[model samples]
Target: MGYGLAVLGLLLVLSGAPAPAQTRAQTQESNDAAEQELRLPPIGSPAAEAMARYAIEREKKEYRENIERAQEVARLSAELQKAFEQRHGLFPDDLRKLERIEKLARRIRSEAGGSDGDDEGSDLPKSLEQAVRRLANVAKDLSERVEKTPRQVISASVIEKSNELIELVRLIRRLS
Candidate 1:
């Protein structure tokens, strides 16, 4: 008990007495840091303040322009889609694929037609769904025609590639 008490006393004494020089050195180091910070240009410096303001304004301008460009792209694409539908009765690429499906991994996007600006898995907006369903019907008809005519399947049909596209659609449907 005496030995334990002696060890506890020693610990308490050591803890209670921090070397004075350590405190002095710490204060001097803090003062040096403060002096360095003070030597830097204050916010009152016109050039530094102007540069900061300019950077902020430039960033704001860039953000605004980006938004405007995205909106313009959406508008233009919608216009192009309408034109394509009017002139060709379906997506232009779909028409091309009907004519020749080779050398093109079926550019038919998951959503179909031009970009409608929908995020991934955003429930496939009703209009986009209708368009995709329409294309699916077209693909189904083509698949049937190819099956009916074996020689045509070898000659007129893009069987292997179309099969891949059909498989991809099936996978996407399962995922959604």
Candidate 2:
């Protein structure tokens, strides 16, 4: 009991609280001294505050751009799905747009901060991989049809692939 009381007394002393009877003037003088001692560097110095602010702003811009890019990809996917549902052959422009969307998705997956790491850490990578695989499978299936009937490769069979693409777009939007 005595040892415990002594330890508690030592802790109280080490805590550096003011004595209970300290006068107002002494308190004010102590506060001024503490402020003077703890003064920061000059305002214009190369402080981490400025760097942190810039980094935060840059991340905000990147995140906003990522969301916009994801939305654009979703829109393109919808256009492709519509064309497929209409039973029209994919034009060169549609092919180009698909390529562009794929490129943008890859860029977002590789460069986005929260998604650059492992697949287990973020669903974006896994969804992106699945989307790419599904697209490749569709392309392969179409190419096989091209071997069998060269002119009929772009038929109603693409509707299923278009649905998969739409789901991929939804995943991308969720990521953003």
Candidate 3:
């Protein structure tokens, strides 16, 4: 295997290929250049430029909206965490909060045109599915907590669920 790798390296050197390592700025510059090229109007009409400007502004608006939604999700997850850590144990409001989280997740998935976790041929992305599964796991952990599990175990489970919720919200934010 070492010899094969050496041979491959030699071939790659001979081919004068550029190294794969790139700084973030370099990558961004390349991406920006590509985007600029793609935005060049085919007919070079003033109307085309106007349309491009409109599209760019619309995209900016959509991006801002998505960020707001992501913030809301994160806030909800934090609230859930606080509820889990309450001295009085799980309250009725906690269940209502969980329902809200589920609703937001479904709405996010729906916006991405994913199925509601029921259809056999669901076109949801793997990340979204994983997030949904994490949500389910959190619910299961909550049940365990409600069953009067040891304090340490319940705390640990809550921590894990909180992390999962954050990750799920992050995934939802990257939908666009």
Q: Pick the candidate with the highest TM-score.
A: 2
Highest lDDT, which number?
Answer: 2
Model 2 spans with C-alpha error above 4 angstroms = 1-46, 113-176
Task: Report per-prediction Cα RMSD to one decimal.
Answer: 19.2, 16.8, 19.0
Would you give me the overall lDDT of model 1?
Answer: 0.43
TM-score: model 2 vs. ground truth: 0.40
Model 1 misplaced regions, further than 4 Å: 1-40, 89-120, 125-176
**Each model's TM-score?**
0.32, 0.40, 0.38
Poorest lDDT segment (10 consecutive residues) of candidate 3: 145-154
After aligning candidate 1 to the native by TM-score, how far in Å is the CA of 135 from where it should be?
Answer: 15
Query: Candidate 3, residues 90-171: lDDT per residue as tens digits?
Result: 3566556655765654443333334434223223336533444454555444334323433223244333333444345444
Tens-digit lDDT track for model 1 on 76-146? 33443455456644455543432332112232221122122322332232353344443344344444433
Ranking under lDDT, best-scoring first? 2, 3, 1
The digit string of per-residue lDDT tens for model 2 on 1-176 reads: 99998887788678876655677899899899999988765667776578667878886676566556556665665666566446544566666767676566554444332232223322223654444444445434433322343221333333332334434545534432
The Cα local distance difference test for each model comes to 0.43, 0.52, 0.51
Off by over 4 Å in 3: 1-42, 87-92, 111-113, 117-176
